[model samples]
Target: MQTEEGMVQDMKVLVVDDEKLVRRGLISMMPWDRYGMKVIAEAMNGTKALECMAAEPADIVFTDLMMPEMSGFELMEQLKLQYPRTAVVVLSCHEEFAFAQQAIRRGAIDYVVKNDLETDVMDEVLERIAASVRSRADNRPEQQEASLHPLFYEGESPVRLHGIPGTEAQLMPHGDSAQQASAEVCQALWQGMRWLYEDESFEQLLTLTAELRLPQSQLKDMVFPVLLKSGYLLLSLEHSLRWISRLEQSRRWEEWREVLQEERSYLRNLLFREKHAAEVVQGILQAVVYMHGKEELDFSQNEVADVANMSRTYFSQSFKGVTGKVFQDYVKELRLYKARQLLLQSSKPIYSIAQQVGFKDEKYFSKMFQQQYGMLPSAYRNQNPLRVE
Candidate 1:
């Protein structure tokens, strides 16, 4: 369909409502073409909506706040995890406004009151959603290389030993035994990494690694190749292998033991650090989700750190390292961003808006808002008024 500028635009939409009449009315009465959107699919419940999405993905989902089988909030949580790019617009009645607000806090772009459904309201919502979609599209890079290896993102190389045949073939006396030992060491190493990723205790990883059985004579030969295959730098692997060989040639069993012990310690420490880094990333993600889902702005770094099961000092350092912003700065940005959206979309009084977005004092909220946007909240609202009267 053509926009006011006469440029053709097409956006796929999915409409979901449990009420048969409401579903039919939205599909039939709304001028989807005029807004450059097509009601490509419809579902009576969140379950059905998910099925429809699997069959044919849509640009936007307009879903009811409450439904059988799966509630709108649950579906939205799933969508945020799985299809983060798909924008959701909640449909609610007057009584469900609170639920709608919760949905917005949880990443929904907007909401519409069913009782106030009209051509103009739908038009405004559609335009806003379309503009957001376009902005995201424009900002995203055009080309992205698909990963071919499972461990690629984990800093592991996809390369395997070239000369060694299958593990079964290499299991014969000298060749087979060494290959078998290598395979076992590799498996143990990967298992240790997995344990670290799951935040399993470092003691557990150390114990598991210690239990792995490999011939001491074959340990260097077996472990070196696996380390190389596991994406370790060639120079480092070569240096390690050379050190082990020199120890063996000199018959310095005591020194060899010391070196091997150091290697094991290093591996354990590496896995622990990797696990800690992963946990930090996960903690930050959870914090952002919590910030968005809550109505009150009273949460603190201590609380979030507790949720992450990390010390406040360490959590703060990791938060800054990963997000490039301190905890307070990041939270302030989120609060101000949400406040700005509320100012533009709702006619709620300044005090109410401040409270809704988690500000206890309106004056403080206005001061922070002005600091962020360089203008008073009221002036900003006046400049970018809601499309709907």
Candidate 2:
């Protein structure tokens, strides 16, 4: 597809799978050029995939969920840390569908079930990825500038900065030369902190700080407060506050620098962990929604795990951790909840309603309903008869 400059940008793709036949089949079947893409490389597993990426970076990676040396999930995490711009799509078998969903939540753009792999599905996924890449490329400058704003102090209008465009001209901060210099240093340090949170390289942080003309002598003192205010430490900010005070009082600039670097590394790791946790929570919530909205109560933990792209064991544990119920119990509760709602709202007979909600035997359904609600389905329906208006 053509970029905004009207230049064609071929999407580079890397196909990864442990199975040789599957990899060969995908490479032969997919019309890469038709989708404005080219398979620049292929790998048998995640370890090989990383090696391939280092040699020839790809815009998109299609990887199998399970592979030797490194699993798809581990590769995804590594990619998120190293190549946040590249998009990932997972391929997995029907049994591992839940694991695929987890991959998507962890930053994979999409997933394809090997059992249901189709040309149309691949086409749709490719189209979506292309659109996303194009959109990001179009908005890159604006996004970069927006990300810079957090570095500014409160009420320090970012629009007025000469480096940033689109505002009425305003004079630079007017005051003592030293005071202005100090402010500039603080801003530089804040910008450095911003980069740290974004998982940027230390070299980029150094370049940005240098560009701001920050004095090296002031680096230690200037950076301390910015780290404290970053809010990344959350519950432990006070503890870090004490440590910062101690470092400053000790007047150990070299040690202070070391501590600051450590903190930045810590913050970067913390941000990634938090982001991963949020994704898992979101994936599980979506699974719960899917469970509640289904027409058939035939859903299994395996199916739910597939939807979340998590292993059944992991999904079960995570489901309990997030929702305070085991996977089976949660699904059973939802099915019964729906049964209750239908019992109270509709005139459908108990047997039909039971079957609709996935209960095969009416007697067993009645027993379950009675056990849950302390009354038979018919009795409950009679007591709360629907009002026809």
Candidate 3:
């Protein structure tokens, strides 16, 4: 243990990876002092890691799942029987998430994806693991809960959360998590943005998104901000916001993956629609993002024209040229789409649902709803009740 000014900061870390660069990156990249941890040892493989542990015990072990001498899984099994006090954190590739899950079942405390470890992102992860380790050492489970999932308001009452700090979430982020996303992840996200102005193929974007994809809990910090940068504002897109909200509420990483798969499919359809190369389409994409944010479909063609900084006639022609849809019709269809969601999720009277979804008259809403969804709102709701979860 190390102490200065009568404070104890004594968590020791052991880093193990087969690749020398990976070992060096994990060791060099960590801000161990901030987390009250010190790197006591480094190893090229699991066998050497165990030797280091036997000589000088560590509080945490950051290990890669695959190695030349002994695999991470085998090392974990040995650690379980040998050093139960030490916690394991799997350092992994995106494709190795399945292995990480198995490691978790075998007693890994957490995981940090190697490919996604931007400096700040890694720091956030370190903070979480540190808090967890601190909590375990102190024998304070309450501190663990308070540190990780800090209190958020629910209605009027302040639900007790042991002794939560000012910050929220178990993950480290004093601010927006998105801003804290790693450079690689952010670059992967911008690959999609590049599609707006470049001739980037839909398949290319798909490959990027697939590689960038991580469990929402793992990715919570970065997706929104990068999406905003790419002009896919969730705030204005009510349905998309709902999708994210539901994803956040999901209980399992598997659920997050499922939701993400659907989101990617939606992006494929929207971003690649009648793909064009001219810069005017970039403006059209921006204008579409800006106006789509308003769920009521309240903005006028002139407003969008102004937003696009083009004459009404030209913007109209270009918007269709880019989207392959008339502006008014697009807005109408989007509003109807939102209405369909409200129908299944809420039991509001058909007229009320119509008004909330931007219909001046219930009859007109029903007409549009039928045209878009093939049924009246109430009938649709009857046919498809609110999903159980």
> Which candidate tops TM-score?
2
Query: Model 1, 14: alpha-carbon shift in Å?
Result: 0.7
Return the lDDT, model 3, position 42.
93
Ranking by lDDT: 3, 2, 1
Candidate 2 Cα errors over 4 Å, as ranges: 1-6, 95-101, 141-389
Candidate 3 local lDDT, 1-389, one digit each (tens): 33457577678899998889888877887788887788999998889999999999898999887576687888888898999878888876532223433554576766566776787676777777876566455543333333223222112122222134553323334344553344355456454454434445433443333333333334554454343333223212323433444444444444554665576556545644665445676678778777656656656789888888899998888777766678777777667756766765666788887877678899988988787555677766664313112
Model 1 over residues 114-163: C-alpha lDDT tens digits? 77667777676566566655644443323222312122123222222423
Better model by lDDT: candidate 1 vs candidate 3: 3
Better of 1 and 2 by TM-score: 2
Superposed Cα deviation of residue 244, candidate 3 (Å): 18
Q: Give lDDT tens digits, candidate 2, residues 1-389.
A: 46568988898899998899999898888777777888999998888999999998888899886576887877888888877777787776532222432553575555566656587766755665566556545534335442222222223323322344564323323354744664675466464444554444454454344333332224434555454444321312333433343343322233444555676666556445434575676566567657766887887778989888899998887777655566777666666767766775567787888888878899998999788656787776664313111
* Model 1 misplaced regions, further than 4 Å: 1-9, 95-97, 140-389
Evaluated at residue 132, the lDDT of candidate 3 is: 59
Each model's Cα RMSD: 20.1, 21.3, 19.6
Error of 3 at 381 (Å): 47
The pairs that clash in candidate 1 are 170-176, 171-176, 172-176
